[model samples]
Every structure is written in C-alpha cells, then in structure tokens.
Target: LIATILLYMGVALFCGCGHEALSGTVSILLNYFDVTKGPGGGLDVFTIIDILKYIIYGLAAGFFVFGVLLLVEGFFTTGAIRDLYGEFKITACGRCLTAFLMFLAYLFFLVWLGVTAFTSLPVFMYYNVWSMCQNSSSMEGANLCLDLRLFGAVTVSEDRKVCTGTEKFSRMCVSDELDLTFHLFVCALAGAGAAVIAMVRRITLSSDCS
Candidate 1:
C-alpha cells in the first residue's frame, strides 16, 4: 500500500513537471525561432501541444482517482486489513475486480512506456542544440544549426527551418529557461519509468492477492 502511494506520487511528479516543461519548450521555440511564422507555418505544432496538454490533464485526474481506489482495494485484499478485522473471505466479485485492476495496470504500464519515449524526444533534441553550443569554440567557422523541420515541429522551408550560429541560438543556449526545461523533461522521463515499474509491481501484487 505504501509502495502504491509512492508510485502515485511519482506519477504526480511526472504530470506536473511534464506540463511545465512542455510550456517552457513552447516559449523557447516561439521566442528564439520562427516556428509559428514562416512560409511553411506550424499550426500543427500548436495543435499537438494543445492536445498533449489536455491528455496530461486527464491522465493526472484519472490516475489520482484510480490510485485511491486501487489502494482501498489493496487494503481489503492484503493480510493487514484481514488481521485487523479477523479473517474475512473476499467475495468472487472482489477477486474479479482485482483481476480487472491487474489487467488495467498492465495497460497503464504500456502507456507509460510510450509516454517515456515521447518525453525523451524533446530532451534528445534540446541536448543536441545544447551540446553544439558547448562545443562551439572548437568548431570555429562551421555552421552549427538546429532544424525544427527535421523533428517535424515545423514544416519544411528553406529560410526559417534552421537556426544557425545566430544571436537567437546563442541566447537560447545561455538561457535558464532551456536548462530548466531540459531538466524538467529528464525528471518527467524518470517519473514515467518509475510509474511503469510501479504498475508492474502493482499487477504482480494484485495477481497474488486475487
């Protein structure tokens, strides 16, 4: 039960950090680059981000309620509650519910795997830009560029697709916003992984109890 609570806490952390990181990423992209305005245009980027925001909000609320219900069910199935209340049999319906929860946990585990991967994509993209900036001194006269079109964040266009060794890139590299967003995404990735593990453990425990 304690472990389950801890797991839910990890999910909460992911939800909070992921949402903030997404907002930070959007801000940096808009301020430093012409993502939304170009011959190619990027209304799709905004649409995707807006959709993800809604999904995250739903996941946060759904997980909170699901966690509470699962914990309550765990209390009934585990020996702790039985010992306190004297040996009581769980009904067939209770066992079925536990089985259903185990299945649901497995599904959630898969979902978290996808979420972790999605979260890592932005981190990976930012790390490339950050690394190029860090090694700028060595690559003298070479054009260090970040292409949003390559990542599908913006449509393909010659003029606005790439950010070269410009003032914007330099400022973006030095900005606290970029650093904070990078770390936040890293935390969110870790949280997603933790949630995956937690769901696996939950399934195992539910299987045993059922």
Candidate 2:
C-alpha cells in the first residue's frame, strides 16, 4: 500500500511539474505578445528575447494541460469517486445534498466557459486593431497619444465627451488586464468546485452498507 501511494505521489508530482511549466509559458507569452523593431535590430530594438517569450508561452500551455491530467489521476486515486458513491447511499438528505453539490460544480464550469467565450470575441478585435495601430505608427506603442484608443471606449458616458482620440499602443496592456480577469474567474470556479466536492461527501465508499 505504501508503494502504491508513493507511485501516485510521483504521478501527482509529474503532473504538477507540467502544470507549472505551462503556466509559466502562458505568462511569458502574455507578457510580450506584441513586438516590433526597426531595421537592423537596432533602430526600433526588439530582439530574440521577445520571440522566445511566445515559445515559452506555448511550452507552458502544453505542460499545464499535462498537469491537469495528472491532477485528475490524483483525484481518482485518492478515492473521491468511492466517497461520492458512499455518500449517495446514505440517508435521503445525504443523497439530495450530494446531488446539489454536483449540480453546483457543473453549473460553475458552464458559467465560466460561457462567460469566457463571450468575452473572447471583443478582446480579439481589440488586440488586432491595437496591434495594427501600434505597428503601423512610428510612435512607441505604450505612448498615450499615439497607439491606444480603447480606453476611450471604457469611459464613454452620456455626460462625458466622446473622447475618440485614443493612442494606438494601449491594447497590449488592456489584453493583459482582460486575461487576468479571466484567470480570476477561472480560479473562483475551481475553488467552488473543490469546496462542493470536499463538503458533500461525508462517508467513504468503503463504509457503505451492502
């Protein structure tokens, strides 16, 4: 039994490693998603470091996928399934509560995915236009006067001015901010799922009466 536990531990460790790698890659890609330089790698000055950022991002994404699979393996190995089954066989209240918990978990994932999809389209358009605005213009992308116009969209109120004259380079930062929002929502859903699983099942399946 100890040996089996050790094996599972190893599997969990492997999965965790992959997850971290992917997360790191995602961070790197997100960090430097936009890059442009003038001729001779000197005038405008963006270099290989910028290029490697995307590669790291891809690598991290791959590992994170692997890590998620590993975590799933750990979940089953830890007897989460058996525990749920045992809880289902208890009193009527226990069964109902378990069902509700599962439902919540499902609902959380569905809501998160729905919102993410809905948010993605506008974000894509913003990033593309922002990128074009920055690259096409001689001014630095980060400058408030040249490349960013999206911020104007954020503060448009009936009482306020139209404020249409936006700089061109602000989209990268806006995109990053959006990514963080999605990450926060994803983390919240995951937390809710974990809470439901941990709270709903009181008895182990091994304890169930035949």
Q: Give residue 82's lDDT in candidate 1 (0 to 100).
A: 79
Using all chains and alpha carbons, the TM-scores for the candidates as numbered come to: 0.91, 0.30
Candidate that would win on lDDT: 1
Indicate the residue-level lDDT of 191 in model 1: 87
Say what the RMSD of model 2 is.
Answer: 14.7
Error of 1 at 203 (Å): 1.2
lDDT of 1 by residue, 1-210 (tens): 765876787788899899999899789878887566434644577778878889989998999888987888888877777788685777789878888888888888889889888888888977887778688768878885677777777666634444546788778878899889988988988888888888888888887876
lDDT of 1 at 160: 46
Q: How many residue-pair clashes does candidate 2 contain? A: 10
Candidate 2 lDDT score at position 89? 41
Those runs of model 1 whose alpha carbons end farther than 4 Å from true positions after fitting are 37-43, 84-87, 161-164
